[model samples]
Target: MILPCFLFTSLFMVKLSQRAWNNVIIVSMLALIMLFNLSSNFLNDDSDAPAFSTLIPQGLLISTIEFSNAKVERVGQGWRIESKLSVSKDLQGLLDVWQSVEVSPFEENLQWGDSQPKVTVWFIGQAEPIEYYFLILADKTLVKLGQQTYQLVNVNYQTLIPTE
Candidate 1:
């Protein structure tokens, strides 16, 4: 009976050690995976997709415009913002102004006339709705888009704005 007890105890101890080693390996593997992910952002991989701005989707139109980048939402089509300068009121007019703009990279902020007066415009396109951000600083405008940024030259600031 004594010999049998000794054999049983030894078997149990061996099984316990095996389970402990397996747990340690699993934990180590998980830690390595996490470290790799955290470092990926710093890699300068040119093939990476362009980072689009955080404009709301399903917002086929600009709902509201404020100075501080808040109070702006991508409201769906058929939504109208009836403020003093509302895009829905005269979209065709604004499009005309945008069409006249020369698409180029923004170089310098030369004009400072319209700096204090910031206007937010909600734009609607045939395919989708997006918010068009602009500084409207002068004859040229600094426009912010999701996929890219541009400087629209030789544009009328007031006509491009949405008005009631």
Candidate 2:
């Protein structure tokens, strides 16, 4: 009778151990799935949309970027920035990004107030400067043409005009 009791106890322990392992495996898989979802930028839905557009026009060299208060102009092979706010250390990289920046059509139509910040890009040999009204929000930067609005996918507000 004692031998039978001992055998029963051992089988119960084995069963509990197997059940605990199964639970652990399920929890691990769930954790992995959650991690993957968090790592991906789920809000960026226009992943398939192409970045390059005719906004700036290809092959044309940019001459100057005039902001509301700041100015960045091409100087020889490099660029010179004039601004009260501290500019990025990689000024050339920032300019190159603006030159060929990727943009997507903004979903909402925004009404511009009287004091909306603006930027004008002047290209070499071009007669007219391309003007764009910009709004810098917490999460994204929106650029407005005459009637259409676009979201700047590659760069942000602080990247273009850093406070620090």
Candidate 3:
């Protein structure tokens, strides 16, 4: 729509005055270039999205965290967040965020089934003894849990829990 309009307007201007044709063409070309550049910039900006992280004191007791050997399974309708960890007191207030939370002498894997329609787990926050899972959408929109929002930052993935 816009391309055609630009071309038409430039052509009409050129038809009105041969002397002004070159100037109109230049202006029209510049306008089209600017429009393309702006649109591409906006599209690229949304590609990776964002995740959040915060620093806390060491030795703050947190449960163990791990991802399933399987890639994050988007089964049924939503993506699953599966992991095993030791239960900790710090997680008491955040239990609602997990699809499943369990403790066992042996590794007990848990899953947050069907997270697709609403959220995508993008980042996981971890400290000396605590671990957290951050979920977001493909567009980098932070997934909200309780009252907190997540954002992505540069961090060590080996130390932090994995996102599929």
Candidate 4:
């Protein structure tokens, strides 16, 4: 402990040249900059966050999806649509859109209209069906699941719901 103290005092006693002191300052500044950058890289990491959020949970096999007027079901390897209203021209394509659609969380609270359509979805092995409500506006399509609402990233209301 005495030797360490002596060495520490000797280091300060020996006067460094002005150029050497400048070099030391530059090196210390570079080290501080490197440390700051490394800390920022670790602090701002977002690897856990997904790039895009899906409307449905990943790998969830939907057994039945009931729209406002139509009910679509999975039969064997294909899908069956039973409806009293107008059916989509490509029912499979519509199913694909629902299955693969991505959504982002709505930032602001919106006052939804009274004429919102309800969509009920039942997954395999799930006892309770998930209910979703749609607030289709002139420009955007919003889906409310439970209390949170999300905006459909790519699909519009007309594509999912067809009318004559």
Candidate 5:
């Protein structure tokens, strides 16, 4: 429908000898394309967040263990997360462990210095419900026992790791 309207208006403009109208049509098309691209980027991010969140298990105790400083970047991915945790205090004698994971770019055209994105972390243990938390930093932070859920918001391009 839009294409037909544009074509008809273009033809009418040519007949009326309105070159400026043609330029306006071209600019309008460009602007429409740009808006579509921007909206698509945001929609894609919003859609993916839920799928990732579903990967976490429910009903288990959870908490964030660590976080890092936000690192902004111009190319290749946006942020990463490093986590260290103690799952259960009763399950003592086990070594304290840390996991590092990379966070993909929220938007394909996301340039450097854009608003920071959030990172969600989930921990699922044997016979245990999933735990998660949010963090603002991108580096490692100490996590206590019995709290297993962690969520991190506004994580930049920094890497997160477990300290203990």
Candidate 6:
């Protein structure tokens, strides 16, 4: 609607050659595309928080290749690491690093920055897997459900390796 009015005004104000009009059209189209692209970045980052279901009532299969590079699973007795040894206090403490994993929403910017090796956890009965991502150099924690949305979760890296 406004385009026609603006075009009409531009046409009366300036008389240009056919080639110039074509160039103008191309430039305007490019500008619109650029505007949409820029706005989409904001739209994606401003999306509502992910809706993470309640904690799995059964158990969880926690796996990661990051700091500890440990693979843990809930066994008949207790947590098992690397599918062999039982979860010791040290190992248990390492596992506790992710215990505060929550699916709460984020109000501010939640942009997915530089990717890192994520700690993937499989909650029994959950359709989506919770993947925790963070930079070892940085202190923030980012999480994503499956492949859809990502959010900055409230978590920090703590040294669970007890001094022996």
Strongest candidate by lDDT? 4
User: How well is each residue in 79-161 modelled by candidate 5, as lDDT tens digits?
Assistant: 23232453222111111122322232222221222233333333334443232233334353212112332233223222232
Ranking by TM-score: 4, 2, 1, 6, 5, 3
Per-residue lDDT, model 4, residue 58, is 80
Model 5: CA > 4 A from native: 1-7, 10-18, 42-148, 151-164
Judged by TM-score, which candidate is best? 4
**What TM-score would every model get versus the actual structure?**
0.39, 0.59, 0.25, 0.64, 0.26, 0.39
Going through the candidates in order, what is the number of backbone clashes in each? 5, 0, 12, 0, 28, 0
| Model 6 score (lDDT) | 0.53
For model 1, what is the error of residue 22's alpha carbon versus the real structure, in angstroms, after optimal superposition? 3.5
Between candidates 4 and 5, the one scoring higher on TM-score is 4
Q: Arrange candidates by lDDT, highest first: which order?
A: 4, 2, 6, 1, 3, 5
In model 4, where is the ten-residue run with the lowest total lDDT? 155-164
- Deviation (Å) of 53 in candidate 6: 9.4
The lDDT per prediction is 0.50, 0.76, 0.39, 0.81, 0.36, 0.53
Instruction: List residue ranges in candidate 1 displaced over 4 A.
Output: 1-18, 45-64, 67-80, 84-104, 114-117, 120-140, 143-150, 153-164
Model 1 accuracy (lDDT, Cα): 0.50
Can you write out model 4's per-residue Cα lDDT over 1-164, one digit (the tens) per residue? 69857865775788999997788679869978999999999999989884448877787788998887788889988888888876646767777888888899887898876579988999998999888889888888999887888999899867776344
